[model samples]
Target chain A: MSKRSDPRLIERVLRGEHAAASRALSLVIDEAPEADALSKAFFPKSGSAQKIGVCGPPGAGKSSLTSRLVAHYRKQKLKIGILAVDPSSPISGGAFLGDRLRIQEHAMDPGVFIRSLANRGMIGGVSYTIFGAMHVLEAWGCDKIIVETVGTGQDEVEIGKVADTIVYVTTPSMGDEIQAMKAGVMEIGDIFVVNKSDLHGSDKALSDLRSAMSLGRTHEAKPWEPPVLGTSALTGKGVDELGKALDDHWTHLKKSEEGRRRLREQHKEELSLYISRRVYRSALDKISDRNLDDLVEHKIDPASLGTKILKK
Target chain B: MESKPFRVLIAKPGLDGHDRGAKVIVRALRDAGFEVIYTGIRQTPEMIAQTALQEDVDAVGLSLLSGAHMTLFPQITKLLKDRGLKDVLVFGGGIIPDEDVAKLKKKGIDQVFGPGTPLTTIVDYLNSRLPSVKKK
Candidate 1:
């Protein structure tokens, strides 16, 4: 650590200093003592970035879709941030975090930043650590941030609450579209993309999504129907359309009061969740060993005991 | 005597999702007696920093296979400097080219471990760079 606290680093990062940004992210992820104070200092300048979450079942090519979307976004001269969450190994409580190698093509781009989060047995599917990461990206001036979930479970649905736009990706052959629909994936998507569209039954998959959308009574909103686009991410087909759809959504959002309201609501939800997690962690940390023994001996139900202790 | 274990945060930056190398490094770091926080693939500079801050770690090690190291590393370094965390050593390993490694080091990256670099190299580097603490 340097003897002097250098605010220049933050300024440099804001000025697009990639090195500075990398360093700052390291500090944040590592949770060094000073990192919190630094982030607090930079908090006022954060939240300018747009957050987008992409989620779907495992093996649905979520990572591939994210890589392609990032490439498309970069072409538009926008700075992008990516977060790929992977499940932790249950036995070891470790994670491979291997998604980074799949998109090595963008390894050198200054306009793109990506991070992989280990689930760490976080029951909600998304890792507890990811929320902090999202805030850091916003502070770094990324125009858009994409968060990819580990699995397409209910936990993945939580992402819809964090992102400004939620894109649900499904491949044609994996029967994921059906599973997604059954899992209520259709309800959360702002945009549905059928990647690997060159495969057999691509049209059928598209029709399935279309029929799924039609099965619902209303189109959700005027001029805001969730559009399904076929994409062969391998060949870069339909990527442009996907990008345009994202732009269109952003434009629509800007034009509508509901969009702003939704954003505000999302922000409130995020803040509440953040605070709740902190409070829960703090309260749990305060639990005494004697209390644990009592609970283990069935002297008290954990929930009621916790409520009683919290009341104090 | 009980001693604090060195805590290290291993993060992946950029859209590259191939984390085989990062995962290997995380295990190596843990086996070497450090408490490792492995942030899985596709991390941005901002996310990495935030996790690092919250975890209160001693070192931040990034694993970037994507060529975005140039853009990602500098931002992380700057953020640390900006937030007054000059002591937390920031290093990484991946498909980074030798020339870029030099550039990153010059930009305050403590070290850059490229492909084919041994896990022992990383373990040794951490052991050397971090302050000595008693292992539990």
Candidate 2:
């Protein structure tokens, strides 16, 4: 385990070796502090990689769309990084993050780097692996990165906190929260997409998304209003347009001051999460099943126990 | 820390586009609590072998229905052998004949599961055969 800190492997990764990067990411996913500390060396190289988050409901074709984006970016000779998250193993509570890409297409491509992780093994539901992975991708010299979250529900907007540009993918047959809601996950998107446009209600879905954006809770005359686009992941329709829209959003972020502001927020959030995890684990270590048992039995109180652990 | 979860790479080799079987196995293993790494479809022997090595998975399950299993199965096995990844168990499924299955098992292919075999059999096979990972 002490040998996991060997810097030679990470050095290999930074020197444009994809296999070494793969090994580093595996160690990073396990939350090895040394591996993460190695990643911090690459922090200065970060903030340059374009962060794009593709999130949507289950079965919304997020994977296929991401595949299209990979192809699009590949055409421009861009080195790409993709962090794909799947589900947790039902029994062991281990993450079952699966690789969604057909390996033959891009596995051989030197310009593309792909890794999979899941939301399991979270410390108080805080994801440090992802943040570390962002750095790893940047250090690996990827020009752009696409993070596709495990398809969460309409109200889950965690992806927005990490990604610079969030693309909300939806199909025409999705629920009403995306179209007409007070404050659902739909509001977090910087670009709205109605995938599977070949199906019925695609027009309605697009129109409804546009209407929602008009009355969007965050649509308060901002410099960058999100564009609603229709796409068919099956036929690769409108994918080029989607790519263009994402580029436009990137342009807006850079042209205006909001992009830097968002990056600042992202940086702060990331640092805050690291701090919170450190504190959480330290505090958690001082706790035991006995403390919970005592609390449950009314032998001890919650407030005092917290203070006692903190004092230690 | 306990043990890392058992991770499997479910790969499809050759031009078989039918993923209904692959997906079924994916869900079953996921439900049974194993991380399934799927790199995509129409993969080559090199891709599967390299993916297994990179992911450091405990096992590799190849699904091929293109009648190329006789070639693809042993090809993946030989690749794994060449990479010195002999510890990584190799199993496969899809339209293979009984004779080919025997031939594959002889070629260092661990097991060949054909159609109509219960998903539970594959699940059980994996559970019993593969070693669990060390977790924290």
Candidate 3:
């Protein structure tokens, strides 16, 4: 009932309490401080789960692809967690949060956990609260985690940096073949998948992808070649093969030091940026003179001043 | 004095654009006296972590309806741990099943509210879980 009494609920959650975990998640979502403590209590035990990032352009059938992958993974009896990030309404700066409607198959599957996040105006494709949720899910013993980004622009490329394996979904109709050739989205893909393959020109799209892959070829002893797979996510065709390919990639990662090194780098970069932001925000909050005193006085340019402050 | 309400970021990570439940929860959280930051949608784990750290939010809530929870949630958790923002609460609500709730709990998810879960329950949970309020 009171914030002070929230610890018991959290305690219950930490001790494998189910109902309390649900309650605590809601509290955290509501931004309650008690939820903060609960998160702290749980943080130490988190981060063992493997995270996979999924991204692509809008209308790429990302939801359908993700849902099929869920079914595929479920067949392996692995505990799965999905984080679907949706686009926010530009006018209200709020998200419709519509991914739930698309993937209704997992609604009753106790082995699956699906959470949606709104972009909330972050420049890159992700939600502010996603990391916390990921950590919580990992600590809960999920073997695999999949993060889906809002499909749009080059921002989704950010998923490549966070996910162990980035699955870039495309459709034959969306001109993804041409889009892939344009550079930004081209290089970030670890695996290229063409969904809605039942449509005409699907083979052409696959060939285009292959040609694109060949064009970017370099001599760096590649561990695994990014493969192009075709699938009709609606009909479940080629879903099994796609799943197998993903599994193969996971296996390759387990055997190589390159994967571990990249993960460490990701962690390092993430931490540094996080700290810088924190320090900058603290300075902003403590500054009492909100008006542009320095800018108006012409003492320093806004861009230069921003860099100077952030450097500290 | 009117205190600066708790800043809460409610985000949808990944490319699943079904966010009706997230919107509903966001409204409920806002009504409960929190300054809610609703990130429009489609976010990477890195973006979400970065936003939380930058915003200095008291809590970060994720809504996932796509089945990418296993991959997405763990990355966010690890990012927070690595960033030393282990104190920020991270929880989620969506189409998660009952069995998965137990698994997520083990992953440090303080809570997991599924479909049909009441808003009042979320409100009460927040009231009970939040730490002592500080006037900004």
A1-312 per-residue lDDT for model 1 (tens digits): 453236686676667655566656655554445666656756665446667778877777778878888888887899888877776666645455546545545655767776656665665446664656676777777899888877665445777667778888888975634554565556888899988898899998898888777666474556688899899878889989988998888887778885777677766765786577667866877788989999889999999988977776
Off by over 4 Å in 2: A2-6, A89-104, A121-127, A175-178, A216-221, B15-24, B39-41, B53-56, B63-70, B80-87, B92-136
Clashes of each: 74, 8, 84
- Top model number, TM-score: 2
* Alpha carbon RMSD to native, model 3: 12.2
Stretches off by above 4 angstroms in model 3 are: A1-5, A8-47, A89-91, A176-178, A218-221, A287-312, B1-136
Task: DockQ each candidate and list the results.
Answer: 0.10, 0.37, 0.04
**Candidate 2, position A73, lDDT:** 92
The Cα error of candidate 2 at residue A179, in Å, is: 3.1
Measured by lDDT, the strongest candidate is: 2
Model 2 TM-score is 0.84
Q: Which of the predicted structures, 2 or 3, would earn the higher TM-score when compared with the native? A: 2
- lDDT for model 3, please: 0.70
Deviation (Å) of A306 in candidate 3: 5.9
As a whole number from 0 to 100, the lDDT of residue A96 in candidate 3 is 50
Error of 1 at A181 (Å): 3.9
Candidate 1 wrong stretches, greater than 4 Å: A1-9, A30-47, A176-180, A219-221, A297-304, B1-136
| 1 against 3, candidate with superior TM-score | 1
Q: Is candidate 2 or candidate 3 better by DockQ?
A: 2
The sequence of per-residue lDDT tens digits that candidate 1 reaches over residues B15-131 is 988988877887786656666766577777866676555444678998887688899899998876776566778898888888887889998888888788888888888887776
What DockQ does predicted model 1 obtain?
0.10
The best-first sequence of candidates by TM-score reads 2, 1, 3
